[model samples]
Target: MKFYNFMTSQDSSVQLVDQAVLLFTLGEEKEAESLLVEYLSRHENDLSAWRALSEIRLSTKDFSAAEHACRKALSINPDDLTSNVSLARILVSQGDKEGAEEASSKARVLGWKDELAQDEHNG
Candidate 1:
Protein backbone atom coordinates (compact mmCIF):
# COMPACT_ATOMS: atom_id res chain seq x y z
CA MET A 1 0.00 0.00 0.00
CA LYS A 2 1.23 3.48 -0.79
CA PHE A 3 1.59 5.76 2.20
CA TYR A 4 0.09 9.22 2.10
CA ASN A 5 2.02 12.30 3.27
CA PHE A 6 -0.01 14.23 5.77
CA MET A 7 2.98 16.02 7.15
CA THR A 8 3.26 19.62 6.00
CA SER A 9 6.56 21.14 4.99
CA GLN A 10 6.07 23.65 7.78
CA ASP A 11 4.93 22.17 11.08
CA SER A 12 4.61 25.38 13.00
CA SER A 13 1.00 26.05 13.88
CA VAL A 14 1.84 29.66 14.68
CA GLN A 15 3.19 30.09 11.19
CA LEU A 16 0.11 28.51 9.73
CA VAL A 17 -2.03 30.82 11.83
CA ASP A 18 -0.06 33.83 10.58
CA GLN A 19 -0.59 32.74 7.01
CA ALA A 20 -4.28 32.28 7.73
CA VAL A 21 -4.48 35.80 9.11
CA LEU A 22 -2.83 37.17 6.00
CA LEU A 23 -5.18 35.19 3.77
CA PHE A 24 -8.22 36.30 5.76
CA THR A 25 -7.06 39.91 5.58
CA LEU A 26 -6.83 39.48 1.84
CA GLY A 27 -10.44 38.23 1.65
CA GLU A 28 -9.55 34.59 1.31
CA GLU A 29 -11.41 33.63 4.46
CA LYS A 30 -12.37 30.12 3.43
CA GLU A 31 -8.80 29.28 2.61
CA ALA A 32 -7.63 30.96 5.79
CA GLU A 33 -9.98 28.78 7.83
CA SER A 34 -8.61 25.65 6.22
CA LEU A 35 -5.16 26.61 7.40
CA LEU A 36 -6.28 27.83 10.83
CA VAL A 37 -8.06 24.59 11.68
CA GLU A 38 -4.85 22.72 11.28
CA TYR A 39 -3.10 25.20 13.54
CA LEU A 40 -5.80 25.00 16.20
CA SER A 41 -5.32 21.25 16.44
CA ARG A 42 -1.78 21.91 17.55
CA HIS A 43 -2.37 24.93 19.77
CA GLU A 44 -5.56 25.22 21.76
CA ASN A 45 -6.75 28.00 24.06
CA ASP A 46 -4.29 30.57 22.78
CA LEU A 47 -6.03 33.97 22.65
CA SER A 48 -4.56 35.27 19.41
CA ALA A 49 -4.51 31.70 18.19
CA TRP A 50 -8.18 31.25 18.92
CA ARG A 51 -9.00 34.66 17.52
CA ALA A 52 -7.57 33.73 14.16
CA LEU A 53 -9.35 30.41 14.21
CA SER A 54 -12.56 32.13 15.23
CA GLU A 55 -12.25 34.62 12.37
CA ILE A 56 -11.72 31.83 9.90
CA ARG A 57 -14.75 29.99 11.24
CA LEU A 58 -16.80 33.16 11.11
CA SER A 59 -15.82 33.93 7.52
CA THR A 60 -16.60 30.39 6.39
CA LYS A 61 -20.08 30.48 7.99
CA ASP A 62 -19.21 27.97 10.69
CA PHE A 63 -21.27 29.83 13.24
CA SER A 64 -21.07 27.16 15.88
CA ALA A 65 -17.32 27.12 15.91
CA ALA A 66 -17.22 30.87 15.61
CA GLU A 67 -19.36 31.18 18.71
CA HIS A 68 -17.26 28.67 20.53
CA ALA A 69 -14.08 30.43 19.57
CA CYS A 70 -15.53 33.77 20.58
CA ARG A 71 -16.46 32.36 23.96
CA LYS A 72 -12.98 31.03 24.29
CA ALA A 73 -11.59 34.45 23.50
CA LEU A 74 -13.96 36.04 25.99
CA SER A 75 -12.69 33.64 28.56
CA ILE A 76 -9.33 35.25 27.98
CA ASN A 77 -10.66 38.77 27.59
CA PRO A 78 -14.17 39.71 28.64
CA ASP A 79 -14.12 42.64 26.24
CA ASP A 80 -12.76 41.22 23.05
CA LEU A 81 -14.58 42.84 20.11
CA THR A 82 -12.90 40.71 17.49
CA SER A 83 -14.43 37.58 18.92
CA ASN A 84 -17.61 39.32 20.04
CA VAL A 85 -18.33 40.47 16.53
CA SER A 86 -17.66 37.02 15.20
CA LEU A 87 -20.10 35.50 17.68
CA ALA A 88 -22.66 38.24 17.25
CA ARG A 89 -22.58 37.96 13.51
CA ILE A 90 -23.03 34.23 13.77
CA LEU A 91 -26.03 34.76 16.01
CA VAL A 92 -27.46 37.21 13.54
CA SER A 93 -26.97 34.78 10.68
CA GLN A 94 -28.81 32.08 12.63
CA GLY A 95 -31.89 34.30 13.07
CA ASP A 96 -31.25 34.94 16.75
CA LYS A 97 -32.13 38.58 16.42
CA GLU A 98 -32.44 39.08 20.14
CA GLY A 99 -29.10 37.55 20.82
CA ALA A 100 -27.50 39.43 17.99
CA GLU A 101 -29.00 42.69 19.12
CA GLU A 102 -27.84 42.12 22.64
CA ALA A 103 -24.35 41.38 21.48
CA SER A 104 -24.40 44.39 19.22
CA SER A 105 -25.54 46.62 22.04
CA LYS A 106 -22.80 45.29 24.26
CA ALA A 107 -20.26 45.85 21.56
CA ARG A 108 -21.44 49.37 21.06
CA VAL A 109 -21.24 50.10 24.76
CA LEU A 110 -17.87 48.43 25.02
CA GLY A 111 -16.03 50.63 22.51
CA TRP A 112 -16.62 48.31 19.60
CA LYS A 113 -18.30 50.93 17.44
CA ASP A 114 -16.72 49.43 14.36
CA GLU A 115 -18.36 46.11 15.05
CA LEU A 116 -21.68 47.77 15.69
CA ALA A 117 -21.40 49.63 12.42
CA GLN A 118 -20.61 46.52 10.46
CA ASP A 119 -23.52 44.67 12.06
CA GLU A 120 -25.94 47.48 11.42
CA HIS A 121 -24.78 47.96 7.86
CA ASN A 122 -25.04 44.26 7.15
CA GLY A 123 -28.27 43.79 9.04
Candidate 2:
Protein backbone atom coordinates (compact mmCIF):
# COMPACT_ATOMS: atom_id res chain seq x y z
CA MET A 1 0.00 0.00 0.00
CA LYS A 2 1.24 3.52 -0.78
CA PHE A 3 1.63 5.58 2.35
CA TYR A 4 1.90 9.34 2.81
CA ASN A 5 1.14 11.93 5.46
CA PHE A 6 -2.40 13.31 5.18
CA MET A 7 -2.56 16.30 7.50
CA THR A 8 -2.26 19.00 4.85
CA SER A 9 -3.83 22.42 5.43
CA GLN A 10 -6.99 23.20 3.49
CA ASP A 11 -5.28 25.74 1.23
CA SER A 12 -2.55 23.26 0.34
CA SER A 13 -5.11 20.55 -0.33
CA VAL A 14 -7.08 22.89 -2.55
CA GLN A 15 -3.93 23.66 -4.49
CA LEU A 16 -3.31 19.95 -4.85
CA VAL A 17 -6.81 19.48 -6.18
CA ASP A 18 -6.21 22.23 -8.72
CA GLN A 19 -2.97 20.63 -9.78
CA ALA A 20 -4.74 17.28 -10.09
CA VAL A 21 -7.36 18.92 -12.28
CA LEU A 22 -4.65 20.24 -14.54
CA LEU A 23 -3.22 16.73 -14.74
CA PHE A 24 -6.66 15.37 -15.58
CA THR A 25 -7.27 17.98 -18.31
CA LEU A 26 -3.89 17.02 -19.76
CA GLY A 27 -5.01 13.38 -20.09
CA GLU A 28 -3.03 12.18 -17.08
CA GLU A 29 -5.98 10.65 -15.25
CA LYS A 30 -3.96 8.04 -13.43
CA GLU A 31 -1.82 10.71 -11.82
CA ALA A 32 -4.87 12.82 -11.12
CA GLU A 33 -6.67 9.91 -9.48
CA SER A 34 -3.65 9.16 -7.36
CA LEU A 35 -3.51 12.75 -6.18
CA LEU A 36 -7.24 12.97 -5.51
CA VAL A 37 -7.33 9.66 -3.62
CA GLU A 38 -4.47 10.95 -1.52
CA TYR A 39 -6.33 14.17 -0.79
CA LEU A 40 -9.52 12.31 0.12
CA SER A 41 -7.71 9.87 2.38
CA ARG A 42 -7.43 12.64 4.99
CA HIS A 43 -9.77 15.37 3.87
CA GLU A 44 -12.62 13.01 3.25
CA ASN A 45 -15.05 15.85 3.85
CA ASP A 46 -13.70 17.76 0.88
CA LEU A 47 -16.55 18.20 -1.59
CA SER A 48 -14.35 18.92 -4.57
CA ALA A 49 -12.13 15.92 -3.98
CA TRP A 50 -15.06 13.53 -3.91
CA ARG A 51 -16.61 15.12 -6.98
CA ALA A 52 -13.33 14.99 -8.88
CA LEU A 53 -12.76 11.39 -7.88
CA SER A 54 -16.24 10.51 -9.08
CA GLU A 55 -15.54 12.25 -12.39
CA ILE A 56 -12.25 10.42 -12.78
CA ARG A 57 -13.87 7.03 -12.15
CA LEU A 58 -16.69 7.83 -14.59
CA SER A 59 -14.30 8.90 -17.31
CA THR A 60 -12.29 5.73 -16.82
CA LYS A 61 -15.47 3.65 -17.25
CA ASP A 62 -15.27 2.28 -13.77
CA PHE A 63 -19.01 2.50 -13.35
CA SER A 64 -19.26 0.84 -9.93
CA ALA A 65 -16.47 2.94 -8.49
CA ALA A 66 -17.99 6.05 -10.00
CA GLU A 67 -21.32 5.30 -8.36
CA HIS A 68 -19.69 4.58 -5.04
CA ALA A 69 -17.68 7.79 -5.19
CA CYS A 70 -20.75 9.77 -6.15
CA ARG A 71 -22.67 8.22 -3.25
CA LYS A 72 -19.83 9.04 -0.93
CA ALA A 73 -20.02 12.66 -2.02
CA LEU A 74 -23.75 12.65 -1.41
CA SER A 75 -23.22 11.16 2.04
CA ILE A 76 -20.95 14.07 2.87
CA ASN A 77 -23.46 16.59 1.58
CA PRO A 78 -26.86 15.27 0.75
CA ASP A 79 -27.82 18.44 -1.07
CA ASP A 80 -24.80 18.52 -3.36
CA LEU A 81 -26.25 19.04 -6.81
CA THR A 82 -23.12 17.93 -8.65
CA SER A 83 -22.95 14.61 -6.83
CA ASN A 84 -26.65 14.02 -7.30
CA VAL A 85 -26.40 14.72 -11.01
CA SER A 86 -23.40 12.44 -11.27
CA LEU A 87 -25.27 9.67 -9.48
CA ALA A 88 -28.16 10.15 -11.88
CA ARG A 89 -25.86 9.75 -14.84
CA ILE A 90 -24.26 6.64 -13.42
CA LEU A 91 -27.58 5.07 -12.56
CA VAL A 92 -29.03 5.84 -15.99
CA SER A 93 -26.09 4.17 -17.69
CA GLN A 94 -26.61 1.16 -15.45
CA GLY A 95 -30.29 0.91 -16.43
CA ASP A 96 -31.57 1.89 -12.99
CA LYS A 97 -34.39 4.18 -14.02
CA GLU A 98 -35.87 4.63 -10.54
CA GLY A 99 -32.51 5.39 -8.96
CA ALA A 100 -31.70 7.82 -11.73
CA GLU A 101 -35.01 9.63 -11.27
CA GLU A 102 -34.45 9.97 -7.53
CA ALA A 103 -31.02 11.40 -8.01
CA SER A 104 -32.24 13.68 -10.78
CA SER A 105 -34.99 14.96 -8.51
CA LYS A 106 -32.46 15.74 -5.82
CA ALA A 107 -30.32 17.65 -8.29
CA ARG A 108 -33.31 19.60 -9.60
CA VAL A 109 -34.35 20.62 -6.11
CA LEU A 110 -30.83 21.58 -5.13
CA GLY A 111 -30.32 23.54 -8.35
CA TRP A 112 -33.52 25.50 -7.89
CA LYS A 113 -32.64 26.21 -4.28
CA ASP A 114 -29.19 27.46 -5.24
CA GLU A 115 -30.56 29.57 -8.05
CA LEU A 116 -33.10 31.15 -5.72
CA ALA A 117 -30.43 31.81 -3.14
CA GLN A 118 -28.24 33.47 -5.76
CA ASP A 119 -31.13 35.59 -7.01
CA GLU A 120 -31.91 36.70 -3.50
CA HIS A 121 -28.30 37.59 -2.90
CA ASN A 122 -28.16 39.57 -6.14
CA GLY A 123 -31.28 41.56 -5.42
Candidate 3:
Protein backbone atom coordinates (compact mmCIF):
# COMPACT_ATOMS: atom_id res chain seq x y z
CA MET A 1 0.00 0.00 0.00
CA LYS A 2 2.94 2.31 -0.41
CA PHE A 3 2.41 5.41 -2.51
CA TYR A 4 4.19 5.64 -5.82
CA ASN A 5 7.41 7.65 -5.35
CA PHE A 6 6.99 10.03 -8.29
CA MET A 7 3.46 11.18 -7.34
CA THR A 8 4.79 14.33 -5.68
CA SER A 9 6.51 15.57 -8.82
CA GLN A 10 4.87 18.61 -10.44
CA ASP A 11 4.70 17.04 -13.86
CA SER A 12 1.74 17.82 -16.15
CA SER A 13 0.09 14.46 -15.48
CA VAL A 14 0.88 14.54 -11.77
CA GLN A 15 -2.34 16.23 -10.74
CA LEU A 16 -4.33 13.75 -12.78
CA VAL A 17 -2.74 10.77 -11.05
CA ASP A 18 -1.43 11.85 -7.61
CA GLN A 19 -4.64 11.82 -5.61
CA ALA A 20 -5.54 8.37 -6.83
CA VAL A 21 -2.05 7.16 -6.05
CA LEU A 22 -2.24 8.52 -2.51
CA LEU A 23 -5.72 7.18 -1.89
CA PHE A 24 -4.77 3.79 -3.23
CA THR A 25 -1.67 3.73 -1.04
CA LEU A 26 -3.88 4.55 1.95
CA GLY A 27 -6.10 1.59 1.01
CA GLU A 28 -9.02 3.76 -0.12
CA GLU A 29 -9.33 1.90 -3.42
CA LYS A 30 -12.89 2.93 -4.22
CA GLU A 31 -12.09 6.60 -3.67
CA ALA A 32 -8.89 6.27 -5.70
CA GLU A 33 -10.76 4.65 -8.59
CA SER A 34 -13.29 7.48 -8.67
CA LEU A 35 -10.45 9.92 -9.01
CA LEU A 36 -8.90 7.80 -11.76
CA VAL A 37 -12.15 7.85 -13.73
CA GLU A 38 -12.29 11.61 -13.37
CA TYR A 39 -8.71 11.94 -14.55
CA LEU A 40 -9.42 9.82 -17.60
CA SER A 41 -12.19 12.18 -18.64
CA ARG A 42 -9.71 14.91 -19.57
CA HIS A 43 -6.49 12.99 -20.07
CA GLU A 44 -7.60 9.90 -21.87
CA ASN A 45 -4.47 9.77 -24.01
CA ASP A 46 -1.97 10.47 -21.25
CA LEU A 47 0.16 7.37 -21.11
CA SER A 48 1.57 8.03 -17.64
CA ALA A 49 -1.90 8.67 -16.28
CA TRP A 50 -3.18 5.50 -17.90
CA ARG A 51 -0.28 3.55 -16.43
CA ALA A 52 -0.91 4.86 -12.93
CA LEU A 53 -4.63 4.24 -13.19
CA SER A 54 -4.02 0.76 -14.50
CA GLU A 55 -1.67 -0.01 -11.63
CA ILE A 56 -4.23 1.16 -9.10
CA ARG A 57 -6.98 -0.88 -10.73
CA LEU A 58 -4.80 -3.95 -10.75
CA SER A 59 -4.01 -3.50 -7.08
CA THR A 60 -7.72 -3.36 -6.33
CA LYS A 61 -8.33 -6.58 -8.32
CA ASP A 62 -10.10 -4.76 -11.14
CA PHE A 63 -8.63 -6.71 -14.03
CA SER A 64 -11.01 -5.37 -16.67
CA ALA A 65 -10.21 -1.73 -15.97
CA ALA A 66 -6.52 -2.49 -15.86
CA GLU A 67 -6.76 -4.20 -19.25
CA HIS A 68 -8.63 -1.25 -20.70
CA ALA A 69 -6.02 1.20 -19.51
CA CYS A 70 -3.23 -1.02 -20.76
CA ARG A 71 -4.88 -1.26 -24.15
CA LYS A 72 -5.20 2.51 -24.30
CA ALA A 73 -1.52 2.84 -23.56
CA LEU A 74 -0.67 0.34 -26.26
CA SER A 75 -2.78 2.30 -28.72
CA ILE A 76 -0.69 5.36 -27.97
CA ASN A 77 2.54 3.43 -28.55
CA PRO A 78 2.22 -0.15 -29.64
CA ASP A 79 5.87 -0.98 -28.95
CA ASP A 80 5.86 0.41 -25.43
CA LEU A 81 7.53 -2.28 -23.36
CA THR A 82 5.90 -1.31 -20.07
CA SER A 83 2.43 -1.33 -21.59
CA ASN A 84 3.11 -4.71 -23.16
CA VAL A 85 4.21 -6.09 -19.82
CA SER A 86 1.22 -4.54 -18.05
CA LEU A 87 -1.18 -5.94 -20.61
CA ALA A 88 0.34 -9.36 -20.15
CA ARG A 89 -0.07 -9.06 -16.42
CA ILE A 90 -3.71 -7.98 -16.76
CA LEU A 91 -4.37 -10.89 -19.08
CA VAL A 92 -2.91 -13.23 -16.48
CA SER A 93 -5.06 -11.62 -13.82
CA GLN A 94 -8.12 -12.26 -15.95
CA GLY A 95 -7.11 -15.92 -16.42
CA ASP A 96 -6.37 -15.41 -20.11
CA LYS A 97 -3.31 -17.62 -20.02
CA GLU A 98 -2.91 -17.86 -23.79
CA GLY A 99 -3.09 -14.12 -24.28
CA ALA A 100 -0.67 -13.52 -21.43
CA GLU A 101 1.78 -16.00 -22.87
CA GLU A 102 1.57 -14.43 -26.30
CA ALA A 103 2.24 -10.98 -24.89
CA SER A 104 5.13 -12.27 -22.78
CA SER A 105 6.67 -13.90 -25.84
CA LYS A 106 6.40 -10.65 -27.78
CA ALA A 107 7.94 -8.72 -24.92
CA ARG A 108 10.82 -11.16 -24.68
CA VAL A 109 11.55 -10.89 -28.38
CA LEU A 110 11.45 -7.10 -28.31
CA GLY A 111 13.54 -6.90 -25.14
CA TRP A 112 16.16 -9.17 -26.59
CA LYS A 113 16.41 -7.06 -29.75
CA ASP A 114 16.57 -3.86 -27.74
CA GLU A 115 19.38 -5.24 -25.62
CA LEU A 116 21.28 -6.30 -28.72
CA ALA A 117 20.84 -2.87 -30.26
CA GLN A 118 22.06 -1.21 -27.10
CA ASP A 119 25.07 -3.48 -27.02
CA GLU A 120 25.88 -2.57 -30.60
CA HIS A 121 25.61 1.11 -29.80
CA ASN A 122 27.88 0.74 -26.76
CA GLY A 123 30.40 -1.38 -28.65
Number of colliding residue pairs in each model: 0, 0, 0
lDDT of each: 0.76, 0.89, 0.83
43-104: candidate 2 lDDT, tens digit per residue: 88888888888998898888899898888988999988889999999999888999999989
RMSD of each: 10.1, 5.5, 6.8
| lDDT of each residue in 8-95, candidate 1, tens digit only | 6454555666788899899988788777666667666567778887767776778888888778887988777666766678798878
Q: How high is each candidate's TM-score?
A: 0.63, 0.87, 0.78
> Across residues 1-123, which tens digit of lDDT does each residue of candidate 3 receive?
886666433475776577778888899888888887787797777787778778888887889988998888888888878888888998999999999999898888889988999999999
| Model with the higher TM-score, candidate 1 or 3 | 3
Give the winner by lDDT. Answer: 2
- Locate the minimum summed-lDDT window of 10 residues in model 1: 7-16
Residue 71 miss distance in model 2 (angstroms): 1.0
How accurate locally is residue 114 in candidate 3, as Cα lDDT from 0 to 100? Answer: 87
* Top TM-score model: 2
